[model samples]
Target: MNWDRLQEKLSILSDAAKYDVSCSSSGSKRTNKGGLGNASFSGICHTYTPDGRCVSLLKILLTNHCIYDCLYCVSRKSNAEVKRTAFSVGEVVSLTMNFYRRNYIEGLFLSSGVMKSPDYTMERLTKIAKKLREEERFHGYIHLKTIPGASPELIHEAGLYADRLSVNIELPTQKGLELLAPDKNHKEMVKPMDEIKQGIVQYKDDKKNKLVKSMKFAPAGQSSQMIIGATQESDLDIVKTATALYKKFDLKRVYYSGYVPVLSDEKLPALNTSVPLVRENRLYQTDWLMRFYEFEPYEIVNADFPNLDLEIDPKLAWALRNREHFPVDVNTADYHMILRIPGIGVRGAKKIIVARRYGRLTYEKLRKLGIAMNRAKYFIHCGKYYVSNDYDSLQLRNLILHSGKSKYTKQFDGQLSLF
Candidate 1:
């Protein structure tokens, strides 16, 4: 391949892969040792040092030539306006190796548009990872997109090499997928995911057997991406689907990419439609609450509240909705109940639990634990410093909203004030 031509393909394919938000490099401790690169378990993206040099993951598509014309996608088969290109398995392996050698990127995130078929596309993707490990001895993070409808054998092979694997859920609802992405099926897409899940399980159980203990398979596990705001599905619907994916597949992450209108089509949102980034952030917060904070999906949003309150985060909103659960005794409340307080987090709650064992907690101790006392004060009583008993739910909500325009609320206001 010509050097200039390769760079051109790199530009196009890398730009094309931006829509995927599941490119975060974490959960895999792929050490370099004598190899060319290292993948830190703690993820980092296009981050910069004080000197302003770039440290980014080389996120790119193996090809942008698609067979299906999904209306929301920029590189759909019917869309001729966008440039199309495909990198050979050797080219991608070479590119990733060269890039890693130069310290340009920490890892490679490889996805592609279905080339000839699911199996054909998946073969090339798996080939790159396999060659990188066997030929180049590359130990850097490799995240390979498991093409939907690919065979189980191919997916299993992919798991053997890639650090993490992802199968995009695309749209939130089946109806939306049917209307826009007619070529795809939800069940067919999930088949590969199920296979990957089983592979991960089998690999773990196999590890117990000394013969296969040295082998690793998709060590970072699997994740999926869902496009938000393109279809009419509410936040509640999105979280529900994510909860199902998490429970069924044992996924590591469910990434939400706010839809960006790339082309004008009768079946798609208008080009001028604003991307719902705030809504995307809120959905991620709700996901965190479910995965880490012990909040159920329904607790975040349900039939009565289909959409998250754009003005407040899901945690604060939940506290506002269930005011009766408030006025908790900070000194006596269990760790779980402490987590329910508006301003307390898992770490803060744990700290409170440990600190209270030594002595009764006062406002000073709570602050020392990094609890947001401004918000917690309204719902917590500690050392005779209880909030006034007069405020109703409505009043308390307002008080929480306007009482302190701290950096957090100011940033929140900046994000949502446009509405």
Candidate 2:
């Protein structure tokens, strides 16, 4: 009942929330001496989900009193040593309003533990979201984690209030789910994903809702997460699951969290620390190909290799293995072909499309269009210019791997160009 106690609970639950992969803030840095708000580079950031989506949100949980004891969870019901608390519907609305009024965050991201029961828990979540929209009239972004197997009616109603909805696929395989989260079923998770996708599509495609904001059903769309290194599943297995999720669920983003031993439970893989950061990074790269590059899951990971290389990114690794696809003439290649180049991105692909429309694109023109020529050179041939023809693939692979060190730093330094 005490407001101070509520704030303390928020601190405990939110700090317990730091490991969640879905909520990382954008890499953008801000120094807030006098502005309305400031952003930290790491820790509790405001990421825009995926694509050019311009929404940022304050990510938080409703309660940490989870009934299920997922081994990796900090608030898993069995975790007696940690703090446990729940926010009343009004408490959540109040905190969101105060934070919004003070310009601390743009909106709310409210997920919850399986408190009490699924229906009761979902009912509580619905209450908080409904209050935020109706009672408080809070119009900022809202992303709610839809409970799996909740009633279709409740799921339908949720789309009306929240800007985005998500259902984490949790583990990549059914075997992993059975071993780790004993209570949850893969079908139980997939059903809600299908329904959310259908609801959003039905809302947008139906002509009957012409005048109705018809509740812009998750205007930002849905997303899911997979915990990496939680089981013996291969990287290929994880990526295949991710690829299917995006294709079937039309997921906006699929977050991959590196596994950490928080609970020290019996079922979890005793991966002492988490899987190395490189593994998580590679999964993200493969996920990018599935979503944007139109690359199939098997194209990158197959029977021969189930994991990604720690030294190089998936695309570059793929490119190095198949040099026949490279040395593409950026001057004459298609948009899809240009996208396969190491340094060029979606914007650069667009530039090539448009610039080529005006005239033949040359190497000089690529630089002006904001392409990273160093990474692009090996993959592209413009006019008469081509990188070394006798270039050793292994040597080239090493060259690409070494250059990755500079990519992130140079990205911030403006030394490497991008779209």
Candidate 3:
């Protein structure tokens, strides 16, 4: 291997892969079979896992050369300014093994631009993964980005080795694709997603029926990403698209990437415009509500409110809008109803339910159960302690905002919350 050339390729391709945010390695329990490494169910990305383990992965692209001219993409074919580089299959496998041995990364996240064709690009990706698993005997996590128009045979081979697969939709709506990337459409993207979903289901069914003792097809399940603020699509549109994808494809995750202006185009946001980080964070919070809090898409966002409130979270926003559901008696409310309160999380609600079996929960006891009394006080009541229900929606919103700010100022000396 040419050391200088390999270093150059790594510098460019690794930087290019930063734009893709769907690189998470959770839900895979690929154990070490007398192999090199193991993939825990806790996950191993550049983020903290559920058990507070900070794991990292070697996220990089195979190549930056492409055949499509996506206006929003920095690695598009029409952009002649970007320095292009491609990594041979051997080089990628070597880099992953060397990195894992050196304690630099726990796994590999490989994506690429459409090199000669979709099949050509996907073939190289699958080959790299195959080499790592079969030849190198690597059991660590492997996440491969599936090309939209790639052949199903190649994708199937990829699933045999990879722990997780992802296909980025790029944009929320078909109209956005038409405007920014005329060559791509939602149909082609959905095809690969459906294929991966079916593959996972088939493996599960076969294992359940005792037809096969050992079979692994993308054991971590599949996920996708959509670009926010790239085109004219409301939050409602994004939420509905995500909800449909989860329902139809059984996706494990749907990531939201705020658009960063890399190229100037008539159809794209300006270079000086700020990235919609707040909107993207709000959308992720809304996704959490839908997944964990049992919130329906229409309940969080509808035609009446097309965009999320940048100031507050989706759960609190919903509680404020429908005041009739407030003043919930925590002592008697069920799990789902208590979950609707602004300050009560899923764990807190479960704890409340378990703790109430002994005696009536007072305000202090409820606080001890880890409920945020600053916001929950206005919407819930315990035994003998009831917050006055005289404040209207507007007044309640202002009060909550004020109290939250004051508490932050007092606790942390006026430092704002990052989220």
Candidate 4:
């Protein structure tokens, strides 16, 4: 019917879509002329229904016709060659509602180009979300991009309607922001994050006050995406920054999106070379360890092994590197100590902790407990019996890789190995 509107929608949305750094779509770094064929981390963009199960969201932008020429972005003012689009806020709301009703998507991830100003753009976004929550009664997940410099009032309001709100920190450091996105300063980004954090905390403390037009502001909590490979920020640097963000901001998740050279900017890195998919993957692995696995950033990525290993995960690599700490007696190790063992996850480790109260856990009980025995065997002993006679680092490393029993393999996700 209205093909012009449809086309406009596509251009605006796809261009806006480029700014999101959440999906760990790797393909940035390539083999240095004499390396592997390809390696990139991949994750699906998630949408969810009212029932709370995850589905695909029509992850798109309202427009890519951005006023601010962030050098890292395809929609930057300087990149005039690329087509731009911005869907009407009403259009976006309708699309999300219709799509959800028809079972096309579980939710909407609506981001936009900063058209007039952060205030203007954020206001439009706020309108879309408000309409969805109040008029439509749509319970699907809504992830809105919080403009970095948007006012505290706008951001505070955003947290009320949006399931999760994010302000893309864009780059890791202040200098990186200055180099890549000129209009976006580091403080502008961090300020919104800080405000959102405070608002969320306030809502949590005042959850009972429903009449105040507030539920837990961003109950899912705030998340941000950092562009990997856009600048020369090392994996260690990126992760270290994430560690600080987590500690300082109480962020729910710090997503790492591999940079793709969609726009041919002189300041940006070359594209079409394999984006560092493996490296991106490894970073997520390390992030998981930091958040859930009880490992610190310093413990995993340090001087000698500055970059994560391409072949093995960070945890397996760490275990191989530090063989002196292996074969932990499963029956007696504390919960924190149990997590350090490769095969045991938080749930599995918790099970081990709970099951042990009944009796001493044996290797057989561990198998039934769904511990990652393949990875676990290298680090854990059961019932006072150490599995390995000696810990030769090289041989132990190889054994652990090949040690995956079918059950262990099924339970363990390679991407999750670093954790």
Give the number of the best model, judged by lDDT: 3
Which window of ten consecutive residues has the lowest lDDT sum in model 1? 410-419
Per-residue lDDT, model 3, residue 61, is 90
lDDT tens string, model 4, 1-419?
47677766765565467546553222122122342122122222344322233436667877676789776677777786877667787778778777777767665677888888889999989999888777777666677889987888999888877767887888888777787777778777889989989987887667666566545477667788787777776677888789888888898789777776666644344543435677778888999999899898888987766777878888888877776776687887788888888767899989999999999997678889888776676577675335544436776666556753222211112322221
Q: What would the per-residue lDDT of candidate 1 be over residues 1-419, giving only the tens digit for each residue?
A: 69999999999998898788787777887756686667778875663322233437788899999999898889999998998988999999888888778877778889999998999999999999999998898888899999998888899999999999999999888998998899997898788889999988988899888776655789999999998877788888898889899999999999888888888776544533856678888988998899889888888898988999988889989887887786798888877888888888888898998899999997788887888887777778787556545556676677667884322221212342100
Number of the candidate with higher lDDT, 1 or 2:
1
Model 3 scores worst on lDDT over the 10 consecutive residues at 404-413
* Model 2 whole-model lDDT (C-alpha atoms): 0.74
TM-score of each: 0.92, 0.85, 0.93, 0.82
lDDT score at residue 109, model 2, on the 0-100 scale: 78
**What is the Cα-based lDDT of residue 91 in candidate 4?**
79
| Candidate 3 TM-score over all chains jointly | 0.93
Q: Highest TM-score: give the candidate number.
A: 3
Ranked candidates (lDDT, high to low): 3, 1, 2, 4
In candidate 4, which residue ranges exceed 4 Å CA deviation? 1-4, 11-55, 208-216, 265-272, 389-391, 402-419
List ranges where model 1 is wrong by over 4 Å: 31-33, 47-55, 211-214, 267-272, 404-419
Report every candidate's CA lDDT: 0.83, 0.74, 0.87, 0.72
